[model samples]
Target: MARAHRREALLAAVLTGALTALALWRVQPGGSGYPVPETPEVCLRQFREAILQGDPERIRNLLSEEMHPHQDRLVREQQPRLTQTLSWVIVQTRQSGQSALVLVHEMHRDGWIYPVEYELLYREPAWQISRISYLPPEKASIAPGTHVREAPWGQELSAPPEPSRTEGPDPEDTP
Candidate 1:
């Protein structure tokens, strides 16, 4: 029947279109575009989105080898806090030859700033977040006892905020 053939063709077209769309959606880079930006502004924007979404996959895509290994740990750290409504406003951004630092004023659902630093490293075509140091950090391995937290990105990402402090002269003060 001609009418039956037409209906079948229409159904097939619809199915094909749906499949194509779904594939595009799934394979799309960062769900924004493939190959996330290495620039400081885009890096911070994507970082905020990844944190808010708590999507580890998105976060991983943005990182290079320097920051990639700790994706799981970063995901675990961010997931619990993702439930809370929050916002990130960039306070400042500093970039050297291959590294960048973004000062983000994270705010609660009520819009009060939660002070923290988000560090980014540019690795050609992408910018990877290297550290997140909460201002006035409590004594911890990941966070310094001072008002500023500074450490190697790889070592700093995994430790808890209140990491145990070994009793001795602080390593940071040596220099």
Candidate 2:
């Protein structure tokens, strides 16, 4: 009877340890101490990294089902080669209920910065990018109170437009 009690106690302890470990694993934040992205902005950052890294499958997974048809073409056009020096920063994000618009500045090796807008939809599990459009410089207006992330590598974030002046005679001509 003593031997039987000892065996049952050992089994119970082992089962308890296994259950505790499993519970901790499930509740752990990303298992690497960094919490998993639960916001649209963080997810968009992940998408940007995936683009820079040229991970086609990750990029496809981050996009919505509606964008699947254009995945091939998008990957061909937007995927930067591993050798290319490129970076991106979020210029603005607007969210209303299930839809969101994220504006980002994509900077290339050359001194060119492009404003790209991504439309995202909050599906059952997470936000998925639905559409992407490149805006002309004149069209990319930043709203007040919008958070603009700084560009990496000393790149200029943006330049405010100069105020328009009424057409008048030049100072030299007037003189």
Candidate 3:
């Protein structure tokens, strides 16, 4: 019984140490928990942080070279809202070649969620954001009363209708 107790205590100690180490690693800056933004998803997270922190320099650093001219405009558009933003959740990411689209939903403190998509291009050093577009909220299912299928709008062609009292109807009596 004493040997079993010692083994249990050793296992618990090892688990507790591992958990603490993982927590610390994630909290440390520049660590694997928050390493440099190499992919589109990570880059977008940095972009979100910069916008919420109101750091224009960081924002400019993350933009593509073509967007350099619009730095001032972009900086002016995003204001510091660290308190207003609860978190930015990444919904999906689509990547093809050097371009990527990251969909993110920004949860606000006011119970509103706004979706935004970021277009990023892979540059030499890292991924750079090229465009930002807002997306409409997705519906769970299509609304009722909406047409599910479509047909041609123009007049349809078919055989002409037969007369109700045709002169040829007398042929029936002959038959």
Candidate 4:
């Protein structure tokens, strides 16, 4: 009876260990026990910081050079407009395998929200943004909406506003 009880206890311990291991595996992020901490949030935070600092070099470091030519073209063509009216506000991110898709909403000075999509790839153990594609907020079903509008500083600037009398606390007034 003593030997039988000991065997039963050992079997129970083994089964418990196996179950715990399986649970951990299933809940783990990267399919293995080790999870990469480079999540979409981290990526967006880094991207935002780079942009606000106006550090194109840092932004380039976060992107694959394979994408540089296309990005450069975009920068040259759109810089004049984008610099004025567009800022990135990341909305959501989804990850699968070594790729992530980031959904961003553009905040315009006029309070318009435009949806854009970015495709990011992880290669050589580092996450690099590969492509940026604009999408219709209504999903791919409808026609693409305008991605940007003309702002005062953009290429399509309208007549400048009349100079404000508020400027310089009235030149005629004494200090």
TM-score of each: 0.51, 0.57, 0.53, 0.48
Give per-residue CA lDDT, model 3, range 23-79, as digits (tens): 665321212244446789888878767776776667777888798898777766655
Report per-prediction Cα RMSD to one decimal: 19.4, 15.3, 17.2, 18.0
lDDT of 4 by residue, 69-111 (tens): 6755645544443454455667888889999999987654455
Q: How do the residues 111-137 of candidate 1 rate in per-residue lDDT, one tens digit apiece?
A: 345566777777655677777677742
**Runs in model 4 lying further than 4 Å from the true structure:** 1-37, 76-88, 137-175
After the best TM-score superposition of candidate 2, give how far the Cα of residue 85 lies from its true spot, in angstroms.
Answer: 5.1
What's model 2's lDDT at 54? 75
Number of the top-ranking candidate, with TM-score as the measure: 2
lDDT of 4 at 156: 67
Q: For model 1, give the 10-residue run with minimal summed lDDT.
A: 137-146
1 or 3, greater by lDDT: 3
> Model 2, 1-175: lDDT tens per residue?
9999999999999999999987665211213332234568977877767777777666766778899899888777776522232556788999999999999876555545677888998876567889989876432243323365732336665578897877998767885
